[model samples]
Target chain A: MITAEQKPIDEIRNMIAPYKRILALGCGSCVAECAAGGEKETAMLASALRMAAKINGEEVIIEEKTIDRQCVNEFVIPLDDIMEKYDAVLSLGCGAGVQAVADMFPEVPVIPALNTEFMGETKDQGYWVESCIGCGDCMLYYFGGVCPLTRCAKHLLNGPCGGSMDGRCEVDPDVPCAWQLIIDRLSRFGALDRLEKIYPPKDWSKKEGCGPRKIVREDQQK
Target chain B: MNNVSRLKKVLENGEFAVTAECGPPRGADPESVVKKAKLLKNNVDSVNVTDNQTAIVRMSSLAACALIQGMGLDSVLQMVVRDRNRIALQSDILGASALGIRNLLCLSGDHQSFGNQGQAKGVFDLDSIQFVRVAKNMRDEKVILGGDPLSSPPDMFIGATANPFADPIQFRAVRLAKKIEAGADFIQTQCIYNLDRFETWLNMLRERGLTEKTFILGGVTPLKSPGMAKYMNNKVAGIDVPEELIKRMEGVPKDKQRKEGINICVETILRLKEMPGVKGVHIMAIEWEEAVGEIVERSGLLPRPSFD
Candidate 1:
């Protein structure tokens, strides 16, 4: 599950205070699993807003709607008609979904109610921690199952720095040292010898320093 | 004592308290919510604004609490740590306190798998017990993340949840005790339909001498119909509807089932009120707010204690 945290209600209210007709749009995808943006959350948000408006003596019209996948164009196309009914949309989807809604309905304003924190998995029932950064590359094969891109504060690809103390990151004591985790995993897999194979510095060209990256499968092309 | 301490005194006075749970709407229209709040304001002692009840998105809980406060009604802002980190949670608590929303319910909400969005991620930075402890720490220390002294520590009535009917009732009680030990001032249990089982659990509390440590609020929700009962039992975990109640609901005429449901809820509340260690009632009408007033009235719980 992608761990997501909801934006403060007062901040959300202030953002949409000017709008009379509002649509609380939920994405039935990542945000849904994280319990941040989904159909149920949409209804709950609607109910809370209705109560808030009543107490504030504000005349606001709110509607609730959810899409299968707000990040995809096909999923968002159907929302155009519904978009016409509301003055603004409060999306419970991730940043991608919110952008998709905005892209599809440029005429209507779209606001994100959740801060799309990071791509993560639920460690337990309600617990989730960051795991991947989708850097268009997978280095877990060399290290371990853990991705240094997300776990390490510096996103180091090599060994742990001197800042590591007792296997904990110096930046945040609560956070475990990512490189230490890598070493442990490598040792468990009997691949500790791989550590001697010094890796060259990462090439920034294939990553974020450059403009947006795209991948095309030659076989899938017409 | 401060305002919050005063509220705590009110609760400790053995007053017949009434609390209503308000689920925010999915969209922006606040009419239905406002109507529900208006209807509940005069009848209940405090109104609970749920935060993403059932993991569904709606209006924000903080905004709803602020709105309820603006209407001059006591608002209990429900906070679910499922989607927030410790920093965010503490920050929100401070913000809520600044907004004059003193009452808070710390919950580890339902898993995302229960909702329509099954693949969404969950952020359980801390469980209910950890959250309650954090709240207590904040109150006692008056310092946040950077060790900066708070301008004014928030005086909040920290609340937690317990489900008496949850499978392995012993574990549930243990968890409840942990929450209390973690600094839960009060506990609001899950909806109850089986009074005998609930009473047995209450007896257990008495046996363990936990009755005096925490204020227990019995949860009551009126079944709108047989379908509603089935949905809750089959779909919602830790919620059980007795076969006899189901049969009674099924036996009732379709048009009158809602009335019967209200009656059942009222009877349960009346029974629970008479039981030992039950501080008050937390009425969860689920989408049927109109019936709450009727249930409270019929249960003879009207004209509740005035804090003023």
Candidate 2:
């Protein structure tokens, strides 16, 4: 899932200070699962903005609303009527959702309240770890379900770099050496021979490096 | 392969080759590299110009190699996969070949976070193994990465680095084997302070007959001081400086530590000369280029072989 965290309140406050009427929007999908831009977070953010405005002797009117998924245009139809009422929208959705809403409401400014982090999984109640980079091409099967492109700091394909020691990455001790994890996983499954075949340089044009990417599915299109 | 590398010729003739490193200046001045190259001109077979070693910015290795080549010294163009993508890398390889640089040392450089620039995005477009294969393909197949024919392919010798001290010790030799299979003609390792561990790695190579496939050059670096030893042991990743070696450095007087370090380096080189599968010694002076000549001379590798 795409994980994100709320931006500092002061920065968010400064962005919305220019407008008197503000809308704190949230998304109920990926960001909601991570407890970042959910319904409760949107309400709390709205309350905080109101208190901040009261302390500053401002007359800012902040309202809260959340959609099932802000990335979807159908779910964003509810905001069409209310978006005209606000001077600016402080979006608590992920980067994609923020841009989606901004694309829909071309007039009002849509400011993001959260920082999009990475595509990762919830490791624990409060901890999250990145697992994928959405590199467009996946080679996890040969690596025994571990993605070296995303996990390894250097994205080494042949084997581990020399910095790995005691199964920990030299870049950060807290992070496990991705190649070690790959080696161990493959070793356990008796698939260690899979690494004998060298993987070539990745074609990064498939990713966003080249430009904006899109998938046109004629079968699924209206 | 049309081997144009002088270093490869030295190794092929059954000579114990001696190579040293020449780090480029942070500034754009060519004189600084010339000064270091002058010190190592007649003392070693070839000099390796590091490409921003440790991620710290320096003059481009290709330009530095050209500078040293003008001084009548062979140069090993150290190419790291950290800063360039496949296009830039292949272009630079051709550029070096065009400028008469015959050697290449392919490496996945130190992470950018370790360098002065923490915010720079690392461009590991090709890992070192893939880099070796790419350079090999460009040289042997006369084709670019996409299989398009190169008008003139590079006739270059390829080198790669190995760290026997890193974790999963048993797999270090296997990694070296992968590099050799990827067309690495020679291997230069991380600086060696623990001979037993190095021999253990070499034994693994010998067992797999990898020793016969490629030339192996043991790496050595003078410590300079006890603090430097401790820094390498604690701070430097992939380097193992034994505690006894540090104690030996600390055993000497503060003013004499540099001399002691050189002595230890010379001793290590002499020992490496006798080890099986060890074809040569690469002295990485690490900003102490003047000491390279003394270390090499004391190890009795003087009067470096020259082919007219």
Candidate 3:
């Protein structure tokens, strides 16, 4: 899942104020579960926009549409007719959905209503916390299902830093020390010996900041 | 306090208060609704425009309130804090007040599961009690969440909901007390069918010393038909119609069921008026506003006290 928080309603109202005909698009995938952009949020945004327009004494036409997955081409294709009708599209999906909409509807301006924070899961109802970084590597096996690369504030791979106090990370007292969690998990799994093995420094080039990464499944390809 | 204080003064002066509810259309067309507002302008003291009743999207509450106010009607803008954050809610309150919509009903609202957008995410940032607290905070201290005094705080009457028929009637008083403690000035209860139960709940409120602090408006919604009675019984939570009343509706012919429903509502209101704690009655005719005049007249509440 991708963690996101909705932008302030006033900010969203201002962003789409210029367009008379606007389509509030939502994605039912990651953002829906996170309570950022989904079908419900799209309707809310549309209602808020209409209210804001009435207050400003401006006439605006707003339409709401939600796709199962706006990050994929299959979902974006269904919006072709509505995309042609609207002057602008306000995407409530995550960053990927905005990009996909933009790619599909180059003629219309695509705006985002959410700030995609990180990849995470719903810790509970109405609460989502970060869990993974998608670092293009599998380190959870060695760490016994804990990924220090993502959970650690400093992204420390081997062990906890000196800043760790009472098993809590110094950067955020609420958070447990990622390396400590890693050690606890490994010991429980009878893999404590893995920590004694000196692992080589991770190559930063394979991460997201480098460039666009691709994975082609030869078996599935034509 | 401005207009609300004035309105309170009018009520205290023994004026027969009048209020009408304006249900927004299901779509964007506001002409018919505005026409309805015009019709009620001469009859009611204030028009209570609902905010997406049942959690379904409609013309916004604020917009409808503004339109009614613009049409020369005092507006009681209904607000549901189920979807808005503190900032948006406060700003909207201020905005509506600026547009001359003074009265407000603070509601937690129907859950989204009952609406067309059941899968839609709901943002219940603050419940009814918290909403009243926020409104009172803005009114008394003029301070917001960031501890900054607002330039001009809104002067709006805060109203909350109470249900006598809600299972475990003690919890209703407890929640009502909480709302009052949170600074709710008034309460509009769920539809009252059982007058004895309602009076008992009122006595409990008096025993708890809550009756003196807040004004309690007994809610009265006339059932249109047997189907409506069944719908309220099965679908609406916290509202339990007595089996006798259901039997009455079931016994009546289809064409005469609506008349029976109105008679039941009028009888309930008359009984409620004789009760000590009730300040007035809020008639929720649902989609049957035409029967409201008859109910009010039948209850002998007509020739309402002059505000002018």
TM-score per candidate, in order? 0.59, 0.98, 0.58
Instruction: Report candidate 1's fraction of native contacts.
Output: 0.00
Please count the clashing residue pairs in each candidate, in the order shown: 39, 0, 0
Please state the error at residue A175 of candidate 3 in Å.
31
Question: Candidate 1: how many backbone clashes?
Answer: 39
Where is model 3 chain B poorest over a 10-residue stretch in terms of lDDT?
B1-10
Return the TM-score for candidate 2, rounded to 2 decimals: 0.98
Summing lDDT over every window of 10 consecutive residues in candidate 2 chain B, give the lowest-scoring window: B1-10
Scanning candidate 1 chain B in windows of ten residues, the lowest lDDT window is B1-10
What are the per-candidate TM-scores when only chain A is compared? 0.92, 0.98, 0.95
lDDT of each: 0.79, 0.92, 0.76
Residues B1-308 of candidate 2: C-alpha lDDT, one tens digit per residue: 23367899999999998999999999999999999999998999999999998899989999999998878788999999999989999999999998889999999999998998889999999999999999999999999899999999997999999997898887787788899999999999999999999998889999999999999999999999999999999988888999999999989999999999999999999999999899998999999999998998999999999788
The C-alpha stretches of model 2 lying farther than 4 A from their native spots are B1-3
Candidate 3, overall lDDT?
0.76
DockQ of each: 0.02, 0.81, 0.02
lDDT of 1: 0.79
Relative to the true structure, candidate 3 reaches a TM of 0.58
